[model samples]
Target: MSMENAIFLQKNVGFCNALKRICIEGFEYSTLYKRIEKMIADEEKKEEKNEKLLVDLWECNLLLSYQLDSKMLSICVPCLLKFALKKEEDEETPKEVEMALLSLSNIKFYRAEKELYLNEIKEIIRNHQEHHNLTRLAYQSAWQFLMNRSLVYRDLKGIVMNELHFAREVGKELEEFAKCVDWKKEKEEEMGKETKEKLVLMRWFHVLFIFFGLCNLWNEEFIGLVGGIAWVLRAAKENHKKISEKYIYLLGNAAKRRDVKVEGLLKIGVVDSVLEEIQQSTLNEGVTFQSCHFFLKISERLKEKTDNDELEEGNRKATKMEIFEKLEEEGYDDTITSYHEFLHLLKVNKIDFDAISLDISEYFVNV
Candidate 1:
């Protein structure tokens, strides 16, 4: 069937219902699986030129990815990875590489046990990192794969941290972009025009790094994770609002982690940034929402920290009073009071916390 027909059926009857009718009522998995298998076999034949057929097979795999179960998805992984890892010869386009990576990322989501293929996926990611420019799609896909893995599999924390370090290195250009006196003005300059283009590419890289860091918020003990947060805070202080929002969301996730130390974040000026954003009268709604969210979490964390005997007596009292004084001095107390009213309005309108995250989709794209 054509893409148009498939889309029409999906829109009219719904995706899952259309899929069920096509797969269950029309063509069964056994038959479709055989057809996919034959297509893969033909693609592997040295004597044949079956690129079009292979592209069609990948498109089907992408569609199946929407609802395939673990077993069915597992059956398709090898073929998908084979296509994903294939050398880009004269005829290959970047879209093919992107599709393959997207399919692998999708299939990896449903598999119950990820251990069996984690190393292979890591290797693919490393390959992309080494040849970064040639494999932008692969690089993005690989980071996304690691992000998903980190969220679902706790044991992969060490690996995820290491990859985040790699991501920071990959995103060094963002550091340069951060240093620009004004990115908006820079974009109008001749030399800065090229930097602007690269900045667009770096957007996803920044989002992925922040997301990966968010997933590891529970592992605050890791020195790399702590250092990463500090780096993000520094960047947040200097970068444009577009980039700063990502850093704010990262801080919010870290603050919300029950195991994280409030003092450590306080020492790094996370509290100051949140307060600064909250105090800005011209702040946009998305930034204001994240600022409010981070403020609420910090308050909760501070209260919990104060109640516990983890800190030395003198230090605890001083730190707690300092934070409270800062809030009152900056009028954050009134902001919180107004935030409560805002949140009550949200509740009355049936807006949930998850919906708030979706409202700020630019910062938290895939999360």
Candidate 2:
């Protein structure tokens, strides 16, 4: 079917349900795979002149992706990889590239030739990380593959480092947002132009989400990047709630890591930022839960470090008392008060701390 006809069917009978029904009612994988192969062969014969056929095939690939299992879909991995790899030698359509990546992203269960396909996927990510229109989809696919395969942390270090570098570079736009002294004026400006600004804001949030994924690796290089964690803290203090929630998630992950030294987080004021979010009455429950969990983690880590006698006196002070003193030096005395008050409120209300801890932890588990 053409894209238009498929969209019409989707509109009439919800896309996923329609696809499921098709899958149930004798949609033969081998036959469909042969049809797609024929289409690809035809397109290649014309030297990529048939954009319409390629698009229809892309739509078919997308439809196939919703199903959890398909042998032919597994076999089609090389063909999808071919589309992705073509970007290196010749310019490809942005839609085709995105569809190819999205198709790869949807293949959650891998059955065929894991190492060969994984190396190809990694090459796609490395070569196209700089693509103007395709980077986000590329990263999304990489995240999917990494999560599904249970790949080692080392497998993703390069991608994580690349994303952090991108975050730091694109993060410069956030400085203007950080410098806005009047929250009311900033809110007004944001609301007035929200339609145009929404895409840009979402792009930034995607970058932060990628950072949240990296925190699972628990790499010291990510934590120790000069302005990496600081940029996230600054974002948490800004006006956007979605962006702030992502920052909270990144902070929560950083605090949860058992291997890395978290002093960089403290020096960058992650504690103060989490406290600020918790004290806010207007934030969502998800944000509040993450902030409280982050607070608890930091407090626990501090206690653990304080009890360790192997550390020198100055190191102890830097990790414990002096960090809070740094908060005071930055004039966050009220923030500290609010932090204490929120903890007291949690205790008094008998809020299940265990329940709150899973909100962020569960998200990372699936990712």
Local lDDT at 363 for model 1:
23
Off by over 4 Å in 2: 1-65, 88-92, 129-133, 151-220, 224-233, 236-238, 275-281, 305-309, 312-314, 326-367
Highest TM-score against the true fold, candidate:
2
lDDT of 2 by residue, 231-257 (tens): 544554546666567667667766767
Number of colliding residue pairs in each model: 0, 0
Candidate 2 clashing pairs, residues 3+ apart or interchain:
none
Candidate 1 residue lDDT tens string, 1-367: 9744643443334223222223233232556545665665667575866655654565454445345556655545555565666666555655566656654544334534665567667767666556653344355555655565556666676665556454354444334434433544554564423343333333444445545455444333333344444444455442345445656776677777766666666775668756665454355555666677887777666555344454554555666678888877765676665665667788798878565643332222111
lDDT, residue 250, candidate 2 = 63
How does candidate 1 fare on TM-score?
0.59
| Best candidate (score: lDDT) | 1
- The global Cα lDDT (0 to 1) of model 2 is 0.52
lDDT of 1: 0.54
Q: TM-score of each candidate?
A: 0.59, 0.60
Kindly report which residue pairs in candidate 1 clash with one another: none
